[model samples]
Target: MSEQLKQQFTKRIVELQKRIDSIHHDFANGRHADWSEQAGERENDEVLNALESEAKIEIQQLSNAILRIDNDTYGYCGTCGEAINEQRLAVQPSATKCIKCAD
Candidate 1:
């Protein structure tokens, strides 16, 4: 189970890293000749920035989860030091809190 969870976390991290790289590539190559198109791209910048930020934060959370798994502490809640539900972990592999602590 630990190996499986570690693989899952690693897979998710790869996916998020790809998304972040794609976002960075888009930002780097943003170019529009038309004024209206430039304005539209600028408008899209805000959305892209928000998305990039969200992806980064999720990546950090997943990385921390991986660390916990490595330290033999992955299934425990960070807040209450109780075992997190297996169902919850199945649903949210990156979860760091048990239901009681979450509430």
Candidate 2:
């Protein structure tokens, strides 16, 4: 990858790391307690829990993307070993497959 693109990806990865850290901190500190309490209905709690779990999973994916960037593998399709499109990377930094391979 070009140095400029690598720098850009590094910056984005750092931003994602920060967001993941914030989410973890909030969850650890019980920041979502109010939401859990205000759920009022069992269904609401269930929905909220599911959403939180999804967010955690996404954060882990972002973290893995950052690791890929550090390892100089970021922008390469894991399935086909092809360069991932810059546009697609901009839209989904954690993506691990090229368009064709993804499809």
Candidate whose TM-score is highest: 1
Model 2 lDDT on a 0 to 1 scale: 0.72
| Regions of model 2 farther than 4 Å from truth | 1-39
Runs off by more than 4 Å, candidate 1: none
Residues 1-103 of candidate 2: C-alpha lDDT, one tens digit per residue: 5456556656755665666566556555542356666455455546656665766676677767767877889889999999999899888878999999999
TM-score of 1: 0.89
Q: What is the TM-score of each candidate against the true structure?
A: 0.89, 0.62
lDDT of 1 by residue, 1-103 (tens): 7788778888988998899899899999967999999999998888889988988888898888889988999989999999999999888878999999888
Candidate maximizing lDDT: 1
lDDT of each: 0.88, 0.72
Which pairs of residues clash in candidate 2, taking residues 3 or more apart in a chain or in different chains? none
In model 2, how large is the Cα lDDT of residue 92?
86
Worst 10 residues of 2 by lDDT: 23-32
